[model samples]
Target: MTERTAKAARRARVLDDIDLRLLRALWMDGRARVRVLARDLALADSAVSVRLRRLREQGVLAGVHAEVDPAVLGLTTQALVMIRLSPNTDSRAYEERLRTMRSVLGAVALVGDFDLEVHLACRDMADLERSVTALRDAGAESTHTQLIARTVAGLGQALLTEEEPA
Candidate 1:
């Protein structure tokens, strides 16, 4: 069999029907109570609780969190940064630097003209400028920054919102 197919088969064996059902229910409602899930799934409360605890222990389920509105925190601007790294720069080192910055919402390595892409939530244009400067100091050869006009689907909402196929 193909390498990718073998990997998929191995992953599939890791989670069974009950595990999938619990994960799906949690995905739908992160804070769902064990009793509620038990009633819905027609399982015992103890069973549901045990499974939930096991999932957490196995690292299958990460802790749930509330999605806070950035505007409420005075973060009024979202910027996308495309970074070109210097030939001698290490992408992992640059990414590590970004991880420590509070304004950086997300960062990823990429291919082509830009070596890295980062998402920033800022208070204003000045904040964005400073963020770009910091990136430059952190081994970015150059950067192109764009202010996000509107977010149609992003920042963990892609799975939450269903859209009609184009």
Candidate 2:
């Protein structure tokens, strides 16, 4: 779908006050018990359950997943590696190859000088070198790596709870 059409489709999923609260609650703790959520929202357990189901059905609530720290897994270093794809490279296959690499935390397609931006978390310089080499093997024509000094903002905060203009 076109970007405009996709955005309009997303905007069609109107989030009311209850929906916002429920989403915020889930964002805080995806594994929170339904009873706890109901109590927090001052709603019945069944109501909370129904709302959650509806949210999932409407594509508002994606599946719950554990966000693991790279450090916890012995990945101490992090870098944002911007890559230019080689000519005739298969974008889908290249991305699939990136997914198989444990050190590649995330990869996103871009519209600027770089074709893809990769988030790499590795054990050390040697591990980072290996990952970059692997990326080149997977079809990166060239790369520019920037070590992350610190994250000014992390993902734990509630993003959707902000007061969006109507």
Specify the highest-lDDT model's number: 2
Pick the TM-score winner.
Answer: 2
User: Per-prediction RMSD in angstroms?
Assistant: 4.3, 2.4
Give each model a TM-score: 0.75, 0.89
**What lDDT would each prediction earn against the true structure?**
0.82, 0.87
lDDT of 2 at 4: 75
User: Where does candidate 2 stray beyond 4 Å?
Assistant: 1-13, 153-158
The TM-score obtained by model 1 is: 0.75
C-alpha positional error of residue 130 in candidate 1 after TM-score superposition, expressed in Å: 1.5
| Residue 125 lDDT in candidate 2 | 94
lDDT tens digits, residues 14-85, model 2? 767888888888877889999999999999999999999988887778788888888888999999999999
**Which residue pairs clash in candidate 1?**
none
* Cα distance off (Å), candidate 2, residue 51: 0.6
